[model samples]
Target: MIRLTGITKQYATKGGMREILKGIDLTIKPGDHVGILGRNGAGKSTLVRVIGGAEPPSSGTVERSMSVSWPLAFTGGFHSRLTGIDNLRFICRIYGVNFDERLAFVKDFSELGSYLYEPVGVYSSGMRARLAFAISMTIDFDCYLIDEVMAVGDDSFRERCKVELFEKRKEKAMLIVSHSHRYLKGTCNRFLLFRDGAITEYEDFEEVYAEYKLLLEEPQKF
Candidate 1:
């Protein structure tokens, strides 16, 4: 189970201190599939990061009973100087897993065959996403956090991922952040709307989408 009580995050801005999240309270249990939706800068990423334990909140508590998988962004966290295979080995070492035994799985699943030996700095965005997604899926965790990752891959690859990862990991809790309401409706059982630095769980996807559409139509009103 995961719970956030009175959670808030403040950032130091050029103008002044800006609060990204203001008094968020949420609870998620095992087997729960949650979709987080919001406009840009609505604190969606901040809330996910805090819950994933990557960042701390300003003045609240985030409690979790399960280990969280890393966020699914292909950012520059991996060293650019090392090869893709080398970085995968490094990640395994960080988790205290034997690299030799996992090498085959990583190579086959990443489909980077020769490119795995090349520096990650040389790979394109899609390649990086494939490598990161493959490696992250290998580890078993109690919860998974996916942040707009499936939108990158081709249709076939996306379907494969949907089956292999999302469908296979039905027992674990999941928090997915995406702008596509259709995807969210199919993937998650619950929906959250983030607006004005607050988060709330909606009764259904329609309710959430209605507000989301309204916000998109009139940004100032929402």
Candidate 2:
């Protein structure tokens, strides 16, 4: 289980201190699959970062009782100077997983081929995203945090990801942040809408999705 209490985040910008999150409280259970939706600049990414512990909230307590994977497609966790293979080995070591055992899986899943031997810095954005997704799958986590970049790669690769994550790891908890309504509807059981630096939970996916579309069509009202 993961619980966030009164979370708030502020960043100093040229315009002054900007509050990205304004008091968010959320909880995720063992089998929950949640989809988060928001317009551009709605602080969706920042909220996910805070939940994943990649960024700290200004004021809040995060209680994580289960193992959590880093946000999927997050390239910042990798060392640019290290080769993709080296980075995978390092991560495996940190997680106390056998690198040798997971090496083939990551290699096959990423499909980077010879590029896996090259420095991660040299890889394109899509390549990096593929590597990140592969690495995330190699490690076992109770809950997975997925950002928008899960849409990486071609249609075939995306379908592969869906099969691996949604079908193969059907029991794992997931928090997905994406603008793709179809993907969210297919994968998630619940929905979270980010608006005015806060999140509104909805049990009915269709209803909330309609509201989400409405907001997109008329952003000024939101």
Candidate 3:
């Protein structure tokens, strides 16, 4: 289980410190699939970063009893100058997994061919995303943090990602952030909406989704 208590994230601005996540509290247990929805600039990505420990919250604590994977396909931690193969080895070393054991899987899944040995800085955005996704799957985490990574790749590649994350890892907990309502409704058993730095969970997907659509339609309201 993972528990977040009074989570608050703030950033310095010209005016003053601005809060992105405001006193949020949430708990996710094993096998829980939680979907998060929010408008642009609503701090959804910041919240995920905090939850994944990629960024620190201004206040509050994240207690994770289960292993938490970083936001799926996130390239922020990659060493840009390193070869993709080297980066894979580095990540596997950190997690105590043998790089050689995972190399074949990532090589096959990413389909980068000869480029896996090339510097990540030289790869296209799509290629980087593919490598990141494949490397993410090389480890077995109890809970996965997904932030719009499913939006990457062609339809066929996306289908394969869905199979790997949703179908293959069906038993693990997932915290997913996505704008695709149909996809979220199909995969997530619980839903949370972000509004004005606060988060709310509704029992019904359609109701919350309706609210999201209404937010989208609003001229300026968020």
- Enumerate residue pairs that collide in model 1: none
* Candidate 2: residue 94 Cα off by (Å): 2.1
TM-score of each: 0.95, 0.92, 0.95
Task: Please write out the lDDT profile of model 2 over residues 92-182, one tens digit for every residue.
Answer: 8888999988989988989999999999999998889889889988888999988886678888788888889999998999999888878
- Sort by TM-score, best first: 3, 1, 2
Q: Which is better, 1 or 2, measured by TM-score?
A: 1
The digit string of per-residue lDDT tens for model 3 on 114-194 reads 999899999998899999999999999999999988888888888999999999998999999999977899999999999
In candidate 2, stretches whose alpha carbon ends up further than 4 angstroms from where it belongs are 219-222
Please state the error at residue 46 of candidate 1 in Å: 0.4
Cα misplacement distance, residue 65 of candidate 3 (Å): 0.3
How do the residues 1-222 of candidate 1 rate in per-residue lDDT, one tens digit apiece?
A: 899999999999898999999999999899899999989888898998999999999999999888888886444577888998888888898888878767787787678889999998999888887788777876778889988878877777677778767778877899999998678988888899988898778868898999888877764531
Candidate 1 CA-lDDT value: 0.84
Point out the worst 10-residue segment of candidate 1 by lDDT.
213-222
Distance (Å) between predicted and true CA of 220, model 2?
5.6
